[model samples]
Target: MELYRKTLTSATWWSLVIFNLLTFSSCKNQPESTVPSWKIKLIANSTSHVTYLVDLERAIDHILRVQLVQVPVFKGKELIVLQNIMALLDNFNPLYKYKKGKANIKNINRFIKSQTEVSQEYFKGLANDDEFATENYIGDDYIGCLGSQSGLRGFNCSLWNLFHYWTVQSSFSPELFQPGAVLWTLHGYVHHFMNCSECYLNFWFYVQEHQIEDVKTHDEEILWLWRAHNYFNRKLAGDVTEDPWFPKKQFPEDKYCRKCRWKGKWQNDKVLKYLKNIYSSISEVVGLINKEEEP
Candidate 1:
């Protein structure tokens, strides 16, 4: 009887040990999630801001394409390009007009609405007038002249010229002129703009949390992004100019020489300094965060 009882006690102890081992092994073998939980939390807490950032990034890409490449060419036949440019500008107008209260987007929103109405009317007029299209297509110069005569101003002219030039010079398929790319690029700009706006909004929230009344203005935030964008632009230009393939091509003495020299020297140096300033600001913010983390 004593031996049987001892045997039973040993079996029970061994069984308990096996159960614990199995449990631990199961835990150890379980697959860990790949996604960062902290990022998820941050996103969840600031969903609107995140969306805004993404849109602003998209917008920035569109803006860069328009300013650096498209606008410079400005030939005449590309109606789609012009439409896309106008659409993007319209989309971003709201950000510029943000106010403190009562929906805060009065000025820009009004401007966009008016522009949209005008664009719709213009398209309707175009559809009705076959003669207008025939007269406009004689040549690049004629098309540009007609567009200007049509009283389309500002970014509209810039957009019209870019695609027109591309169409005149390149053998690209007509389908390539579809406005979808413009929409997608504009989305990037909107993403970046929203990101910037959220950064400011977050700063404002932080200020409020600390009971601080003073806050940076929206203009200041826009200027900050503009400066950053310009810095990046110069960096990209410098990279291109420094390439062995670039400077070898003979440039026009009257136009390209001075511009290339400036790009290589003063502009590149200034951009580097601007980028350094941005880095310094970021480092200071990081240091503050680290200090706060210290218990």
Candidate 2:
């Protein structure tokens, strides 16, 4: 009887140890929690109107100075797409107040149009051209697109901001271009020039999956881009590349625009109004530019 009792006690002890080991192993193998440590909210100054424009200008400079020259191939449809992008920027870009900067945009467009095939060196020379002198006129630093980490969100974020800005500005000036021209141009740019293979594929698939060609009306185009941007935000949330300080969530969170949502549904008219106010409204633009230019 004594021997049996001792055996039973030992069995119980071993079982308990094994159960705990299994439980711990199971917990260890489980996926890491998606909940971030930092409280997520829109960082207020990150999205200021003038900062958006300034960042857009910086992004444009990056494109002219760096991104364009890196294009691996400059033939066939690629050349036409590049020319079209430059022409679109020359014609529709609203932020170019300085004469030399506007001249640079025009000169680049003309250069691409004149070239049957452009080497990377040719592009480099065009970017470095003394006649254009882009650095003298446009922003050379990023204000709104600065990420917490060294390379988290500078160029990619700036491009999206510029895309949204162009879409809104297009809505405000429909006669200057087609309703979907800005997005179409964006698609071509991403399809050809966006260096990240994964990012380019994601954008290409999204454009195809969502019927980007069918976006017809100006209002629809504005909202389409808004929705598209939010789609990317949702996709990239919690990604390793995400900036913790600027956590990706739906844009125009209630903190930014109270009327943008009600009962968890997007009030798109109010959202449109908000976008226009930030991107295209003259009074707001004047105020922001004044504040931005302040010494």
Candidate 3:
């Protein structure tokens, strides 16, 4: 009986030791799953309104690519032109004025000149034996030029007409080209099209008018915009709700539901318009190009 009891105790001790060893070994060997984190930072300063989207601790790498590498390669002169326009616009801001530092207007002009040269060279290479005019210049001829034929001309003309009617012969000036004004103008264009399904359908037709090759299919673009629209909506709304850091209280004036009403309305309107126009244009151009190829 003594021997049996001793044997039973020995077995129990050995079992407990083995169990503990197994548990420790399992825990030590277990792999950890990493979750990806995305961070979007909006930097609105005197000279630039920069929006940076990146993973945490990876901002420097992303910024280097965006500001130094990708912008030069992908956009080149177009980026410089945009930067110049943004800088000019930034100077007019009452809150923050752009200051010309080491890179003055001359530097900007030089950059623009360089970009134009690069663009011309690029076009020349593409033209090859064919005449330059024969090649499809959707963006270059139709969109880039300031002439009446340009789409931007049409957009600006429509905006000016609307603004003039509303304001009763308000003198048109560059001062009117504020970000808020631009946003409203874009909103109006979107609202106008969306209200008319036929016009909206026609808007896609107009995009097809551009006839860009290498453009995304209409269905694919629509799907992408739909996804993006939903994502932004969810992200912003979630930020408003889930983030304990954001203020929840109403202000003293609290006019327009403490600005939340305005925000929600504008956000939805702007996002929808942006998505619609981009998708419509891309789809239209691709469809047009494909149709032309078929015959």
List ranges where model 1 is wrong by over 4 Å: 1-49, 53-58, 61-70, 91-94, 98-295
lDDT of 2 by residue, 182-287 (tens): 7666655654565322223344455555565577788888888788778767876776666667778898887778888999999989999998787764221211
What does the lDDT read for residue 94 in candidate 1? 19
Best by TM-score: 2
lDDT, each prediction: 0.27, 0.62, 0.25
Clashes per candidate, residues 3 or more apart or on different chains? 30, 0, 2
Error of 3 at 83 (Å): 5.4
Q: Which candidate order results from sorting by TM-score in descending order? A: 2, 3, 1
- Among the numbered candidates, top lDDT falls to 2
Question: Which candidate, 2 or 3, has the higher lDDT?
Answer: 2
Could you tell me the TM-score of candidate 3? Answer: 0.23
Candidate 1's displacement at residue 156, Å, is: 24
lDDT of 1 by residue, 1-295 (tens): 0100011122222223212211211212223334343433342233121112113322222343333232222222123233344443343331232222112223223443344233434333432344422322211221111111122111322232232222221112223333223322222322221122112231233223321112133222222323322332343343321222112122122242243235444343343333333222211011011233459
Measured on C-alpha atoms, candidate 3 has an lDDT of 0.25
Looking at model 3, residue 223 earns an lDDT score of: 30
Identify the runs in model 3 with alpha carbons over 4 angstroms from their true place. 1-69, 74-106, 117-235, 239-243, 247-295
Q: List the residue pairs that clash in candidate 2.
A: none
